[model samples]
Target: MSKHLLREISENIVKGDSIRTKQLVEQALEEFTPEVVIKEGLIPGMETVSARFQSCEFCLVDVVVAADAMQKGVQILKEKCRKEKAFAPKGRVVIGTVEGDIHDLGKNIVAVTLEGAGYEVVDLGVDVSPTQFVKAIAKFQPDLVCISALLTVTMLRMEDVIEAIKEAGLREQVKIIVGGAPVTQSFADKIGADAYVEYGTNVVYKADELLKKKGRRVALIQLPSILKEKHQEIFRKLFDFTPTFLDQNNRVILQGEELPECCRECREWNYEHNAEKTVVYSCPGGLSIIEARIEGDSIKLGKIICGPFLVETPGKVCVCAPGAKKVSSLELEKIAIFTQMIAEQIQIESREKLLQVQLEDQREILIRALKFQEELKNALNEARYRSLQSQVNPHFLFNSLNSLARLAMLEEAEKTEKFAYALSRILRYILRNIKSTVRIAEEIEIIRDYLFIQQVRFTDRLSVHLRIDEHIYDGLMPCMVLQPLVENAVVHGLEPLEREGMLEVSGERKGELVFFEIKDNGVGMSSDKLREISQLKISRSGRGHTTGLGLFNVHQRLQHYFGSNSGLEIQSQQNKGTSVKVFFPYIPQ
Candidate 1:
C-alpha cells in the first residue's frame, strides 16, 4: 500500500502537480516513516526530473515547475522527519551570482538542482559582491560555494571573490564551483575554482565528489602500501616536504622529520587549547602546512607542507612549488587539490579493505582518479594561459615604440613627445585599471590621444573630428573601451586608403541610453564581408589585420558590460564608408 502511495507521489512530482504532491505526502506520512517516504518517493521523483532534464525530454520551465512540486513535498516531509529524528542533509552549499551581474535564471536552476539533490542551500541571489560572498562564507560555513556569472564582464569578478576568500583566510575551508553561460573550465581554473560544472545538474555530482575528497582520511599504517610507488613520488614532487602522521598522544607514527619550530608551537597550542577544528600555520622557513583532526579517532593528520610560502588560516589545501620566494593563491590551491587526491586514494584503500569491495570496483575508483588527474593537467595548462594573458602584449608595445622612434628620427620633436606621452598614458591606464571601470570622459581623452598618434602617422591623408556632449561625460563605462573602437576605425577603415580619409567620433544621450558613433570614409567593406564579420565567421587573418580582433573584443565587452541590446551596430557599403554605432544604458556617476 505504501509502495502504491510512493509511486503516486513520484508521478505527481513529474507532472508538476504541487497540490497532488502535497496531498500525497500527507497521506503517506500517516502510514509510513518520513525517511521511507523521502527516500522512496521525493528523491526518486526529483531524480527522474533531473534525468529528463538532462535528456532534453523536459525543458527548463518544466524542470523548474517539477522542482517546485518536489520542494513542497520535501517541506511537508521535513516536519515528519524532524519529529522522527531522521532528517539528514546531503551537504550544505552557499551560492550567488558575481557582482555587476543580475541575471539569475542559471543561478536559480543550479540552486534548485542542488536542493533536489538533498543539499541545504543558501541562495545569495544576484549582484553579489566579493565581500558579500566572504561574509556569507563566515556566517553559513558551507561546504561549497557556487558562483554564477552570465556575462564575460562579470565573470572576471570571480577572481576577485577568490582573492577575497584568500584574504579572509577562509579559502581552504570550502570548495568553490563556478558556472554560467560565459564561464568555461579554463576560466574556472584561472580563477582558482575547485570545480567547474558545464551542466547545472552536474553540480550535484561535483559537489559530492568534493565533499568526499575533503572528508577522506588514511590511517598511517595503510598509507604507503595503499599508494604503492606513487606515494613517495606525490610527497616529494607535489608537497615538497615529507608526509607525517600522528597518533592521539602526539606521538609520530609514520616518521618523516621533526615538525618545524612554528608547526611544533602550533601543535602545542592546539593541545593546550583542545582545538577540535583544522588549523593552518606557516613556519619560520616560509613553508605552509595544514593540520586537520581525524574524525572518531585519536589520530590526527599532521601538518602537510604545501610550498615555500605560508597561506592564511582556513584554506583547505595549499599547492605551491618548492624553493619559491612567493606563491600565488592559485598555485597554493593546486597543491591543496593534489593533496586531496592523495588522501582520496588512501580513503579508497581503507574502504576496499573494510568493505571487501569487488576488484572491478577498485578498478573503477582508479579510473576515476586518473580522470581527475587529467582534469588537473588541463587546469594547469589553462593557468599558464591566464599567466600569459595577464602580461602586456610585446608585439603591440614594440610596434608603438617603433612608431615613436620613427617620428623622433624624422625630426618631428613635438609629434615624438606627444606619441610617447600618449603611449605612456594608455599603458598606465591599462595597468592601473585592470579590474575596474572609468568615466566616459576619461575614456574619450585616451581615445583622443590614440587618434592623435594615428593622425601624425597618416599625416595629411587622415583627419578626425570629435563631438561629445559634456552632460554625459561623467557616465561610467569599462576602461579601455573607446580606444579599441577608435583604433579599429583607423587601422581597418582609414589606414588602408591612399586618398584622404575622414573619421568622425561623436556621442549623445537619448532618453535612458547613451550612444557613440565612429564613422570612417576609407575602405568600406562589402555586404558579404560585413555579414561574415557580423556572424563572427571570418578569422583574424581573413578580416585584414587587427580589425576583426579589436572589433570583436570591443563588441563582446560592450554587450557583457551593458546588455545584449548594448553593442556595436555596423553599417557599411563597399568603397563608400563604415559607421559603427555603440550604445548603453546611461549610468551616471
Candidate 2:
C-alpha cells in the first residue's frame, strides 16, 4: 500500500495536482520518511517534467505547474527534513532569475529540482540584480551561485553578476553556474563562470563537479517493467478519459468515434516546432480539447497524444459529449508531462522486452506450454462431451421423419410431404446451430419452416407476417433464439384463440444494434402473468412444449452473452395481445 501511495504521489505530481499533492505528501509521510517521499515521488516527478520541457515535448506552462505541485509537496515535508539526516541538506545555494528578465519559471524549476535533490535552495525570487547576487553571497556564503535568464539581452546580466561577486571578494568562497534558454557554454566561458548547465537535473551533477563533491546526490527515475503497449487504453483507465492523436504528418489521427476530430492537413501547421506548442483544438461539436505531441527523432518513431477533454463544460451539452471529458486548466498542464512519459516508457519497454529475455527462460516457457497441450485438448473434448450429454438426441427423430417424408412423397400426398420436409429442416437447423451463433438470415429460414408447419395445420385460422429488414440479415445473434419465441406464439398464444390468430416477426438494424420483435394477437396474458414470465417464475406453456428451449432459457442466454442490455421483455393485456421485444449487440461476421 505504501508503494502504491508512492506511485500515486509521483503520478499526481506529474499531473500537476498540487492540492492533492500536499495531501499525498502528508499521507506518505506517515509511512515513509521525508527523504524517501522526496526521492521516490517528488524528485522523480519534477525531473520528468523538466526533461519533457528540455525535449520540447512540454511547454513552459506544464513545467511551471508541475514545479508548483512539487513545491506544494516540498513545503509539507520541510520541517521533517530538518529532523531526518539520511538525505540531509547537501549544501546551501542562492538561485534566482537575472535582472531585466522577469521569467522565473526556469529559476523556480531549478530551485525546486535542487531542493528535491536534498539541497538547501534559497530562492531569491525573480529579477535579481548583480548587487543582490553579491549581497546574497556575502550573507549566505553559499557553496554555489546559479543565475538564470530567458532572453538574449538579459543573459548578459549573468556576466555582470559574476563580476560583482568577484569585486565583492566572494568569488573564491563559491562556484557560479550559469544556465537559461539564452545562455550557452561558450557564453559561460567568455563570462568567466565556472560551469554552464542546460537541464535542471543535470545541474546537480555539474554542481557536484564544481564543488568537487561525490556519491550520487540524485537518483534517476525509470518506468517499471509492467509499462507496455495499449498507451491509449492505459490513459483512459487511469484518467477515465479517452485521448486522441495526430499522425507524423500532423494530420488528426482518428479512431472512428461519433464525435469527429479536427482533420486539418499536415502542411497547415508546422510539425518541426510543434513540440513547443500547447494544442487545444476546438472540435466540430464546439468542445475544446488539450493535446501534446511526443515525436521521435526519426519519422518512423510515432507519437503519443493526449486530448479528448473540454477546456470548460458546455451550456447545452453536445450530442457527442460523452467522447470528451472536462478538466481544469491545471490538470491539462499535467497531461503534457504524462503523455511524453508514457510514450517513451512504452517505446522503451517494447525494445527491452526483446533484448532482456534469456534463452533459458524462453525455452522453459515454450516447453511448459507444449507439455500442457494434450491435457488442454482432452479437457476441451470432455467439456464438449458433457454439454452434448445434457441435450436430447435429435438425430433419430430426424432420420425417422426423413423416411416418413419419402413414403408420403411416393404416395403423392403433397401436404404430408411438405409438412415432414419443413419439420426436417427445422430439426437440421437446430442441430447445426445448437452450439454456434447464427446470422439473422440463417435463423429466419428456420422460423419460416416453423411457421410453414403451423400454417399448414391451422390453414384458415392462422395468419403470419415477417417484416424483417435485409440490413440486419447479416447481424449475428445467439443460436435458437428467435425460434423459441415463434414456437411460443404459435403453440400457446394462437392455439388458445377462438377468433383469427395473427403473428408478426420484424427486425431491423438500428445503429450498432439490431432490434427484434416477436408479437402475437391471440388470447393475451394478464399483467400478473406477464410479470411472472419476466421474473422467470413461470413457463409460457406450463408443461407441454414445442422445443425444449423455453422463453426463460433464451432470456438467460441473451443476458449471459450480451449483458443486461439484452434479454426478454414481456408486455401484454388480458385477452388482448403479447409482445416479446429483444435487443443485443449486433456484429456481422
Candidate 3:
C-alpha cells in the first residue's frame, strides 16, 4: 500500500502538482523515512524529467514546474529529517558557471542530476568569480567543486578558481571538475582539474570514481537499421503521433509527407548537422511538420519524420485540411521526448563492424580518390550518391546549418575555430604526402590534433600527456607513421576498456637514435595476439589499416626507410595495457 502511494507521488511530481505532491509526501512520511521518500519517490520523477529533457519532451518551463514540485517534497522531507536528525546526503557539491560567462543551462542540469543522485548541491549561479568559488569551498566544505563555462574565453576562469582555492589552502578538501560546451580534457589537465565530462549525467559516476574507487562505463552507440513500424507505435501510444522515416536524401521510406512547398524557403536548413529537433515547426503551408534528424557519428542518416499535423483543430487557430491530425502545444513537448528516444536508440545500437568496413572502404577510396577525382565528380553528379540519397535544397540546408554554426560560434567560437582548423590541418597533411618522409615534429603535431579531436569526443574518458625533447622534432620519419600507432592506442587500446582512459606519447633522442613511444592504459593484447601483430605485414601500402592506417604499415615503412632495427617493438598483456616503441637512426630532415 505504501509502495502504491509512493508511485502516485512520483506521478504527481511528473504532472508538476506541487500542492498534491506535498500532501502525498506528508502521507508518505508516516510510513517511510525521508531518504526512502526522496529516493523512491522524488528522484524517480526527476529522473523521468531528466530523461524527458534529454529527449526534448520537457522544456525549461516544464522542468521548472517539475523541479518546484520536487523541491516542495524535498522541503517537507528536510523538516521531517530535522525532527528525526537522521538524513545523510551522498556528498556535498559546489557548482557554478565561471565569471565572465552567464550560461547556466547545463549547470542547472548538473545540479538537478546530482540532487537526484543524493548529493547536497549548493548552486552558485552564473558569472561566478574565482574568489566566490574559493569562499564557497570554504563555507560549504563540499566534496566536489564543479566549474562550468560555455565560452572558450570565460572557461579560463576555471584555472583562476583553482588557483584561488589553492591560495585559500582549501584545495585538499575538494575535488574539482570543469565542464562546458568547449572544455576539453587537455584543458582540464592544463588547469589542474580532477575530471572533465561532456555531459552532466556523468557527474555522479565521475564523482563517485574520484571520491571512491568505483568506476562507470561510457559507451558510444549507432543505429544499425532503419526505423520500423514498431517504433512508430511507441510514438502513437505516447503522443497520438506516428512518425515517418526518410533516408539521407529525404526519400520517404515509411509513413511521411512531402515537405510542404513553404518548407522550400528552409531548403538550406540542414537537420543532420546537430543533435537537436524542431517542435511543431510550421512550414509555409498552413500545415505543420514535427521533425528530428537521425544521425550517427555526426552524419545524418535520416529523420524520424512526423507531421503536416495541425497545431490546432481546423478553423480554430488556423484552417487545416480536413484529414490532418490536430496536436496540442503540450503534445509538441511530448514529441521532443519521443524524438530524443528514437535518435538515441539509433545511436546506441552497436554498428562496429559496419562502421569499420566503411572506414576501410573510405581509406581505400581516398588513397585513389584523388586520381579519379574528375571521374568521381562525374559519377557523383550523374550516378546519384549519398548513404541515403534523397533530394534536398542546398540553400535552405546551408542557411540552416550556417545559422546553427553561428549560434554555436556566438557561444564558443574559439574552441569551434580550433577544432575546425585542427581537422583541416590533419586532412590536408594526410592528402599531401602518402609515400614521403617527414619531420618527427610534423608527426607529433598531427598526433596532437588527432588526440584533441578524440578528447572532445570522449571527454572524461580520455586524458593524454605528451613529453618530447626538441632534439627529435626535426628528425625524419615516414609520413603518417606515428599517427596510426597513436590511433591504435586510442581505438584498439583505450576505447574498448571500461575504465577511464590514459594515453602517453613521449619522444627523446639518445646518441645516434630517436625513440618514440605510444602507450595506453587500455584492454591490452594477449601474448599470442601480440606475436600475431608482430608477424603481420602490409601487402602494399599507399596511404594506411583496419582503422585508417595499420600498425604493420607503419612498422614496414619504418624498416624500409631506416633499417630492421628501426621498426616497431610491441609488448602487451591482456587487461593490462600496451606500449609500442619506435626507434630509428637520427636522420635529420
Candidates in order, TM-scores: namely 0.39, 0.36, 0.31
lDDT of 3 by residue, 186-265 (tens): 98999899999887657878987776521111111123254567777877777676677776667666774444554545
Candidate 2, clashing residue pairs?
Answer: none
- Tell me how far the alpha carbon of residue 304 in candidate 2 is from the true structure, in angstroms, after superposition: 69
In model 3, where is the ten-residue run with the lowest total lDDT? 213-222
Output the number of the TM-score-best candidate: 1
Off by over 4 Å in 3: 1-412, 537-547
Residue-by-residue lDDT tens digits, candidate 2, 106-125: 57656666665678878887
- Candidate 1 lDDT over residue span 255-292, tens digit each: 54344444444532221111334344454334555454
Q: What global local distance difference test value does model 3 have?
A: 0.71
Runs of candidate 2 with Cα error greater than 4 angstroms are 1-393, 539-544
Instruction: Please report how far candidate 3 places residue 87 from its true position, in Å.
Output: 99
Q: Against the correct fold, how does model 2 do in TM-score? A: 0.36
